[model samples]
Target: MKHLDINQIKEIIPHRHPFLLVDFIEDYEPGEYAVGYKCVTYREDFFRGHFPQEPVMPGVLTVEALAQVGAVAILSMEENQGKTAYFGAINNCKFKGKIVPGDKVRLETRIIKRKGPMGVGRAEASVDGKIVVSAELTFMVGQAGKND
Candidate 1:
């Protein structure tokens, strides 16, 4: 089992605080798959405006979190080192449930196909074993530039 802490995850992906969604990667296989977690808290900036009265994690952000998990799987490959994976497209995306603060989202993304610098990942986000979101994400790998 390959476990990755936040720092290790940062080494593989370029996301940062407030945007870096995955809190801990439970395990991963380079170019294969990654399972991670995101501990949602009330202090999150988005909750402030997303719904002060009744906070809810935005669906888009959840998808991004799932994407980040996929990024870890893709970017961890030796050939992809120091590279960035950008979303080429998001297909079959479905929001099945809402994510709330205090929920620990379990994220998983499996690389289903790859060709050259492009690939597709089957992603899912769950809380307490209940699927909240699922999508097929297409990615395009490219050189990581400072502007990325």
Candidate 2:
């Protein structure tokens, strides 16, 4: 088992700022599974417009969080470092409960299968031990090209 702080996570996944949904990875097993967290806060940029009076973390962001966790799980594999994970598809995504500011979301992801450069994963987001969102995420790992 290994743990990934934010800085280490930055080396595996290329997400930043408002787009970087996972705060830190709590635990990980290369090519197997990973757990990460996101702490929702009132100060978030989206909260201001999402709803001023009733701030809630958007469902889409929850999915993004799940993807981030899945990415960490896959990239941690010894064969994948320095590569990039690209969103391939999402399936069976369901939002079960409202996630508001101040909620600490725990994201857990496990790899379901892998073939060549593509992998499939399942992930869930929970709060207080209750599931808030769940989905199957598919992604492709490949060499990262230089940004234009």
- Choose the strongest candidate by lDDT: 1
Per-residue lDDT over 1-148 for candidate 2, one digit per residue giving the tens place of the 0 to 100 score: 5788889999888889869999999998888889999988889999888888899898998998898898888887888887888888999999999899889999999999999889899999999999999999999898888331
The 10 consecutive residues of candidate 1 with the worst lDDT sum are 139-148
Clash pairs (backbone) in predicted model 2: none
Tell me the deviation in Å of residue 46 in model 1: 0.4
Model 1, total clashes: 0
lDDT of 2: 0.89
Residue 147, candidate 2: Cα error in Å is 12
* lDDT (Cα, tens digit) per residue for candidate 1, span 1-148: 9999999999999999989999999999999999999999999999999899999999999999999999999999999999999999999999999999999999999999999999999999999999999999999999877443
